[model samples]
Target: MRPETEADLADMIASASGPICVRGGGTRGVHLDGAVLETGGLSGITLYEPGSLTLVARAGTPLAEIEAALDAEGQRLAFEPMDHRGLLGTSGAPTIGGVVSANVSGPRRVSVGACRDFMLGVRYVDGTGTLVKNGGRVMKNVTGYDLVKLMSGSWGTLGVLTEVSLKVLPKPETAAGVLIDGLSDVDAVQAMAKALGSPFEVSGAAHIPRGLNGQPVTMLRIEGFAGSVAYRADQIASLFGGMSVRVERDPETVAKGWAWVRDVDTFQGTEGDVWRVSCTPSDAAGLGAKMKLAALLYDWGGGLIWARVPEGTDLRTRLGAFDGHATLVRGAGQAKFQPEPAPVAALSRGLRARFDPKGILNTGLMG
Candidate 1:
């Protein structure tokens, strides 16, 4: 648990051996074992360029704390990664930098894009112990290579982020959700796709398995002013037709409900192995058809599916067969967050050459 000040970071980068997991309270400790870089020492907001709709903060700032500040100004870091401290059945603080580095996206990703979209700039200690920066506080800069987006999802293999600047948006004044209860996996995917194709401007849509479904819900959430959300939700309901619907006007209920779509908070106690697979929405059902798993949960409409497998069930070849990637999201790891190293994974090995040439930052993570 070595916490480094800015100067200390400069010194360590020059001499450190072994991969350093830049940890923020170990929110993701289960994912890997490497030398830890205790990023909390670097925590603090450096700048809030509200005029440009951007804010810069140290890497280890608590995401909850950042959101509270953003809320006060009616602004938010829009990608909205799921708070896994509670949902993953774990306990600890998660950092916003960690979220972006992980490239996590929640329900709003359907509308706003992932954390990669909002990230604008970064300062980090790279493999060579040199301080490197890319992008700027504003969105339009292209002074050099677009390293900001590259760093966003690099999983700290390239560098240990010291600071990050990102775009922010005004929080919507009101939001409403409508549930279309009792739809099968294929049907639920259809409804979500249909809703997005329409002009109702729906912000969130998801379907949970009926067995896993607490309330048998197929939910659609719309955000804006009271009048706008109310109007859009009504039109969406009309578009979907009467399927035993119930309106959720309660804001707190709406927030809590959408969270399930983010990270399967409701399915926490289910033990075994959980995985997050990225594929086309249509491939979601194929995942069920393919993998023999303990349980499965779908999020991101269907683009992201979470499956709980009996311990030691290999999802690699099965998931890779569907032409997508499966990451070990939780539970014990053969090697956490990593699937059994793929044959063509030398591509990742090659990437390490250009970024962390010395493999001094986070070696095995993306290697």
Candidate 2:
């Protein structure tokens, strides 16, 4: 089922019985047993103000469309949302609604913030087919309950988003990468931490256990005016003077390198279950060491670890208790999301009850 208008969407949900599978672009590899409700029919940008760095678009507006519009204005989505197509092996164009629902974020999240931080407002339909609007087009317009943040990262469990207003940032004038070779996972995490701590404003930090040339590489990214980027890259390189360091100044090369890191390209087309582990930067190495991984990629200055293990591996049980959570991104027979603590689980149940009394939206997807 697809509805082109907001009213039509609300009516469709209002009249629905049994479960409904909410979808946008169908890129996230979420499958549930229910009638499918695709939001693609509700597409297009509603508003864009380059000077104000704000954009409003329907839920199903293609992310490429929004990126193109922002690029024309020398701006971009600061969160640097990842393109999950390659990683998930899905072909549909990613949509703004899916980005928000999943709270998709990339390497730059270490410097800026997650997709939820840039959200200025949101319009969604509750489970009862009621339209709910929260916040507004401007930051100051957000007051009272901040449903905008709650809706993000909800994975469509709470409601079906119809429209979104976002705050964007100006594109950097130039960017550079400082590559340090031959660092072990622990050492790489330490090096990345030092680079991120320095005043050079590292925007992206990642470590590939096995890089393209079959060697471990740690990357630190800096972006700004050309001169600033160059100077900062040199300073970062100097921080690891004893190690083999090379500064990549070519704009295309830097962009491509970061994109590869952001999208977890290393694990693409590989056979294994993928797990995204979120922990403190200091704990990342320890967790990775405990895992029996086939491949690993570290991003967000080692705060996020992507582990590829043999199919049907129960990573959570193997790792035991930890400071953060592990999410199954692919190859799932076990649970996809981490089980919440009893208190948190109760709170989540309460929220779902309030938002979706009928429990018809994306039933059992989160479980």
Candidate 3:
């Protein structure tokens, strides 16, 4: 089922009799048994204001279109959303609604924020076929319920988003990456924490235990004016005086390198189940050590761990209890998301009941 208009979408949901699988771009590797509701029919950019640093696009508007428009104005989506096509091997144009639905933020998320942070407004259809619009096209909109945020990262379980308004940032004049080699996972986390804490403004930090060349590399990114970028890179490199640090100043090289980290390209085509682990930065190395995975990639300065283990491995069982959560990003036979605490689980159930009384939207996808 595909609806081209907001009213049509609402009506379609209202009339649906069975479970519905909400899909946008078809790139997230989500599979479920239900009637497919494709949002691709609702496409196009509705508004864009370079001076105001804002953009509004329909849910199915191709992500590339938005980025190209933003680039023409020397602006960009500050959250640095990841492209799942390479990692998931899905062939479809990513859409703005998909990004918002998944709250897909990339490496710069450590410094800027997640996709939800920049969201200004959203228009979606709830389970009962009601059209809901919350927030607005401004940064300081504080009217009623903050449903704009609630819709984000909801994975379309609550509603199907029709349009979204976002805040954008000016593109940097230049960017550089400082690469530190030969550091163990523990040492890499420590170095990343130090770099992030420094006043030099590191925008991206990641560690690949095994990179394209089959060597360990810790990357730190700085962006701004050319002179500022170069100065900050030198300062950050100097912080690790005795370590092997190489500064990459070429704009294209820096962008490509960070894209690699943002998309978890290290494990893109590799064999095994992939897990996305979120924990306190200081506890990352300990958790990784416990898992003893086949490969590892650290992002967000160690706050996020991507582990590749043998297929059908239940990583949460091996790690025992910790102050973090492990999510299965690839492979099956186990739950994908970590089980919420009792209190949180109750609250989640309550919200779902309230939003989707019929429980027809993307049923059982989250679990």
Candidate 4:
């Protein structure tokens, strides 16, 4: 069921008997066996306000197109949403609706926020064939239930998003990186935490494991006007005095390095099951030490850990002791997401029932 308009989609859902799998470019790679509803036909940007740093676009609008439009205005989606095509091994086009539905964000998420933070508004069709609208085109348009936040990460189970409004930010004038060499995993995590606590406003931080590439490297990023960026870079380098410190001032080099960490570029080619684990930064050092048996990297100042474990490894059982959740981003594993607690699971089921009375939307995708 390909919908060219929201009305068309609502009518189709009104008549659907069996389950329906909603797709935005279909790059999510979650194999849902049911009638597929493609959203590519409902494309195009509806509005762009550079002065206000706001953007409204159809849900099916290509993410790349929105980025290009933002780039032209020296602005961007501050959350820095990631592109998962490489990791998922799928060639389907990525759409803005998909990014919002999945709540995808990149390295800078450590500083700014996730996709939900930037989502100001959304228009979707609930499972019972009801056209629902929540939020508005501006951040101050707060009037009712914050369903926009709820829909951001619902993965199209509660509703089918037809449009979205996001809060964008001006691009940084310049950027630089302070790279510390030869730090052990534990030491690297501490160093990143220190940098994040400083007044320089570190925008990105990650550690490349020594086991993976011979020498461990800790990277800290600062972005702003040229003078401020240079001053902060030097200040951060001075903070790491006596260590093997290198400042990357070249814009291209800085971008390339961060992009590598943001997209998990190195692991894209590795043949193994990849897991995205989120935990408190204080717990990251311990978790990394325990997971030393596998290939790993730390992002979000050690809060987000991306690990590549051997195939058929039961991650939930292996990581049951940890407080955070582990998501299987790749491989045909037993589960792709962490199981919710009993109470939370009950609430989720109840909410699904209210939004989708017939249970006709992406059944079992969350479990």
lDDT to native, each model:
0.76, 0.93, 0.93, 0.90
For candidate 2, the clash count comes to 0
User: Which order, best to worst by TM-score?
Assistant: 2, 3, 4, 1
Candidate 3, which segments miss by more than 4 Å at Cα?
none
Model 2 per-residue lDDT tens digits across residues 1-367: 9999999999999999889999999988889988999999989999999998899999999999999999999999999999988989998999999999999999999999999999999999999999999999898886789999999999998999999999999999999999999999999999999999999999999999899999999999999999999888988899998899999999899999999998899999989899999999999888889995458899998899999999999999999998999999988789999999999989999999999999999888765
TM-score for all models, in order of appearance: 0.92, 0.99, 0.98, 0.98
Tens digit per residue, CA lDDT, model 1, 3-112: 55667886777777766666665666544566667787888887886667888899888888888888889998777788776546667788877887888778898888
List pairs with backbone clashes in candidate 3. Answer: none
RMSD of each: 2.3, 0.8, 0.9, 1.2
**Order the candidates by lDDT, highest first — what do you get?**
2, 3, 4, 1
| Distance from true location, Cα of 264 in model 4, Å | 0.6
- Model 1 segments more than 4 A misplaced: 1-4, 31-34, 211-215, 292-294, 333-347
lDDT of 3 by residue, 1-367 (tens): 9999999999999998899999998998788888999999999999999999999999999999999999999999999999988777788889999999999999999999999999999999999999999999998997989999999999999999999999999999999999999999999999999999999999999998888788999999999999999999999999999999999999899999998888888888878898999999999999989888458999999999999999988799989999989988888899888999999889988989999999999898775
Error of 1 at 156 (Å): 0.9
lDDT of 4 by residue, 73-151 (tens): 9998888888888877788788999999999999999999899999899999999899999999888888999999999
